[model samples]
Target: MKTLSLFIAVCIASTCYSQLKKLPIKKTADLHAFFHYTGKGERIISGHRGSYLKGYPENAIETFAYVLKNTPAFFEIDPRLTKDSVIVLLHDATLDRTTTGKGKLSDYTWEEVKQLRLKDRDGNITPYRIPTLQEAIDWARGKTVLNLDKKDVPMQMIADLLRKNKADHFMMVTVHNAKQAKFYFNDNPERMMSAFVKTEDALKEYEAAGIPWKNMIAYIGSENKPANKVMFDLLHARGVMCMISAAPVYDKLATVQERAAAYRDIFAQGADILESDLPVEVAEAMKQKH
Candidate 1:
C-alpha cells in the first residue's frame, strides 16, 4: 500500500507538469498586443450576469438590452452545455441554485430546462429562460461584448461559434489549470483562449504554453492575492500583458470602491480589462477619481 501510494503521488505530479508543458502561451509582442490596454482607453463597462440588479433578470436577453441602454455598461453572460449538446446561457451546474427547476441540469432535456425561470441572487424568480449560447450571441451581434464564462466544459465549440457568428467583438475568460490551458490552445491553434490566474506559478504555466497571455484575463483571489504591483512586475518582466478581477471568490477587500481605488492607486494595477459588477463605478472611479 505504501509503495502504491508513493507511485500515485509521483504520477499525479508528473501529470501536472506534463500538462503544463502543453500550453502555447505567447511571449513578448504576440501577448502584449492583446492584454496591453484592457479597460484603459475603452470605457466598456460589462455587467455581471446581465447586470443583475435588485429587479432585473439574470442571463435574460431583456435584462441585457436594458443594461446596454440604461448605463454605458455592456453585458456579461454565460454559456453552458446541456446533455443534448446544446449550449445554453446559465451560471450554475444545477438549475436549483439559480432557477425554479429542480434536479441536475444534465438530467433534463433542453426543452424542459427552458421552461424553468431564472432566480435573482436573492432567490426571487425572474422571467428568464435559459438562452442558448447561439441565441445570446445572435442577440448581441453588434451591440456588446459577450463575456463567455466556461466553468468546466472544454472550449472547442466556443471557438467555432465565434468564427461562425463573426462575433469577434467580445472577450472571454475562464479559470484554468496549466493542462486545461494547454489543451484549449492545442485543440485549435487559431482560436483564442482567455483565463484567470492567481499566482506567479499559474502565470508562468500560461505564458510557457505560448498562448497569447495578454488578452488573457486573470482573476484576483479572494484572499492573499498577489498585489497588482507584484502581478504587473512579473508580467511586465515577461513582456506579457494581463487583466485582473475581483473574483475567483469575492472578498471583503473586493468591494467596488476598493477595486476602483486599486484601479487608481497604481493605475496600471487595474487590470488591462477591469471586470466588475459596478462597471459604472469603476469607470467613474478611474475616470473621475484618478
Candidate 2:
C-alpha cells in the first residue's frame, strides 16, 4: 500500500512541474529589443498614453497599431477588470469620465461594457469598441511590446491568463509596491516582474524569500532625477532593467523639446528601456543626432 501511494504522489508531482514548464516564457533580449536597444544608444521611445499625444485613443488597439508602424516605440496600456471578472482596458476606477457610459465602470461586465465606445479627452466619441486582454494580445503579437499597467485585476488572473495563453513572450508585468509583487510571485513564481524598486524592506523580504533577483525589474526615482541613473545602475548590476516615464511629468517639464530630451537623457543614465507618451516626438529628436 505504501509503495502504491508513493508511486501516485510522484506521478502527480511530475505532472504539475510539466504543466508549469509549458507556461509561456520570454527572453530578456526579445523584451529588451522592444525598447530599441541599439548597440550604441541609451533609451528606446515609448508611446505615452498609447499614442494619445498623436490623437490616438489611449488604450485603444488602433493607437497600438499606429505606434508599432511609425517607429520602434513600445506601447503602454492600462488594464481594469469589469464587474464580471473580465479584464478591459481602462485607466480610471470609473468609466463615467473616460467613456460616454454612465455610472461606475465596475458596474458593467465585458459583454455590457463592449457596447459603449470610448470618448477622447475632447469629448469626440471614437468608433473603437472596448477590447479584452486576449484581443489586445492578438493585436500586439509580432508588432510591439506591452507595458501592462495592472490596476484592477487580481494577480492570480494575470498569472492564469499568461499561463493559459502562453503570453509571457509579449508582455511585462509591474506592481505599484513590493508587497503586491510578493503576493503575485509567491502564488506562482513562474511569472516575472520587470520593476518593483520601492522599499528596501520589501527588497530584503523578496531576497529572503528565495525568489531570484533576475525575475524583477528594478527602479528608483532620484530626487536629482525623477529617479536618477542610480535606478539604472542598481537594476543593471542585478541583471534586470529599470523603468522611466515614456514622457514622464510632461506637463511639469519646461517644454515639449525638454520632455523629449529627458527621454534620451534617461536612456543615457543607463536605462535599458524607456516608457514615453510622446514617442513620435522623441523619435524625431533622436533621429536628428543620427
Candidate 3:
C-alpha cells in the first residue's frame, strides 16, 4: 500500500506539470508573430503579477504555473534590484506586504531574501520564496511569455540579463514611453515590448521613435472606453495587438457576474489582449462568451 501511494503521488505531479499550457516561441520573430493582431477577434490573456489566486503568491513561479494549468496566458511581473544588485521578482519596493520579511527589498541580499516566505494576496504565508529574475526567465523558456514590468532595475541590467539567458523570445519589457522603448530597441531591435500607447500622443511618440510596430503590443489602458476605439483601429491597422488591463477596473467588480460581463465587454470592444490580476477567473468568464 505504501509503494502504491508513492507511485500515485509521482504520477499526479507529473500529470499536473504536463498539463501546463505552453507558448512555443523559439525566437524574436516568433514572439512578434504571436502578438501581431490579425483582426479575427483573437483575445490573449496576461496575468498581472502572475495571478491573484488564493494560497498562490503573486509573482511566484508556483502562481504562474497554476494559471497556465487552467488556461493559456502570459504574465506581467515586476523586477526589482536587491542590495547586491541581484534582480528578483517582487512588486513592491518594500517586502512587508508580500513576504514574511520587513523593510525595503533593496536592503536585503538575495541570500537574505531567499530566507523569507511569500504571502498570498490574503496575507497567508506560503511555502514559496522570492524568485530571482534569472530563475523566472529560465523557467519561462517554452512555458509562456513573461512581460517584465518596470521597477527599480536599470534597463542596462535587464538587457544584460536577457542576453545572458537568451530570453528575448519569451521575455518582454513594459516601457512607459518611447524613450524607454527606444533604449531597448537600440540595444536589440528584435526585443519585444509592452508599450503604453494609451493616447494618440503616446502612439505618435512611438511612431516618431522609429521602433518597428512588429516588436510591440500596445497597452491601451485599464478601462474599455469609447476613446479606446480610435487607438484600437490605429494599432490593429499596424498589426499591433492592443491590451486592456482589468487589474484595476473590472477585477474589482463586486460580483462574479459583473466581472464576467466586464471581461466579455473588453473583448467585444476589440481589445486583443486582457491583462488581469484574476487571470483564472477571466479565463472562466471569457468561456461564456464563446
Displacement of the residue 93 alpha carbon in candidate 1, Å: 1.2
Q: State the C-alpha lDDT per candidate.
A: 0.58, 0.63, 0.92
RMSD of 3: 1.8
lDDT of 3 at 106: 92
Tell me the tens digit of each residue's lDDT in model 2 across 197-242.
6555656666776666656655454222644554455555556556
Per-residue error for 204 in candidate 1, Å, reads: 2.1
| TM-score per candidate, chains pooled | 0.69, 0.77, 0.95
Model 3 agreement with the true structure over 99-191: per-residue lDDT tens digits: 999999999999999999999989999989999988888778888999999999999999998998888989999999999999999999999
CA lDDT, candidate 3, residue 183 = 99
lDDT, candidate 3, equals 0.92
Instruction: Report the C-alpha lDDT of model 1 over 1-290, residue by residue, as the tens digit.
Output: 99999988986643332322111223323322544444344333446777555555578776666555445444557777787878887777778877888877777788888888887657888766778878887766545556677654456677677767655444443546766667655654433444666678888787787776544545544333335567756655554445444333231245766766654443343344555554445556766644
After superposing candidate 1 on the true structure, give the runs of residues whose Cα lies further than 4 Å from its correct spot: 1-35, 38-44, 71-76, 168-175, 187-190, 222-226, 236-241, 247-269, 284-290
